[model samples]
Target: MKKTKLLLISLLLTDFVMLLQPENAWAGDVQITCDLRVLELTSQQRNQIRLRRQQYKTRQRQMNENLMNQNVTDRQLSLRHFFSKSAFDNQQADEIAKQRYANDVRQTVAELNFYHDIFQLLDNRQREIWLQQCVQPAGRI
Candidate 1:
């Protein structure tokens, strides 16, 4: 009985660890598809682009964490005011919303720069291939 219980616990822990793995852990398909559609490049160019993509992803994750932290702080502040029975001002709320929107725009611009850098790294023919395979579908190329 003891051995069975221990085995079950071990299995549960393994399952939990697998569940906690990051979403991008399995990106083989995406890379393969990109390689097939994009123009031929030197292995070094491919590796460099892969490294840049990873860096961009890391920066994006950090940005998301910062945004979440900011949201939590704002929510806590609102809760504190509510507990104090403070009156909510519509104007103040509107200003906060505007500020958040402006921040979102700035973040979007930064993300665009990362994408533009990736596009710039691609040769003209590769860029065209990328557009046809990915971006042009959405008329976003």
Candidate 2:
């Protein structure tokens, strides 16, 4: 009985440790970018990707700032004190959706441009590596 209890406790502890381990799923741009390590990029290519990523981040920040400014204007126009909480939430959601929809095309163009720049930098072998090891495995290709 003691041996059985000890074996069960050990199995439970092993299971708990496994549960704490990080998952393999790379879900975001940042995680996908990290997976670029598998591409074996040259110094020049890495530098180019770094610069492109910086530019992308800057554009995204600017776009977000514009959206925020528009949201501020929208909030200023809405009389928050008059509406019930649910009504205020609905109005805020609508405004957010409008802002996102308005910027969707620009954001997509920027992102596609960024990826295109990165893709253009790769040679055939590197491109295959990128596609198979980085993009395909990430379920992004």
- Candidate models: Cα lDDT each: 0.65, 0.70
Candidate 1: the clashing residue pairs are: none
TM-score of each: 0.52, 0.53
Q: How far off is residue 72 in model 2, in Å?
A: 4.8
Residue pairs in candidate 2 whose N, alpha carbon or C atoms collide under 3 angstroms: none
Model 2 reaches what TM-score against the true structure? Answer: 0.53
Candidate 1 regions with alpha-carbon error over 4 angstroms = 1-36, 71-91, 137-141
Which 10 consecutive positions of candidate 1 have the poorest summed lDDT? 24-33
Predicted candidate 2 versus true structure: per-residue lDDT over 1-141, tens digit per residue: 999999999999998886644333222232234377777889999999999999999999998898766756555445454354554577666765675566765776787788878989989998887665555332343
Cα lDDT for residue 94, model 2?
A: 77
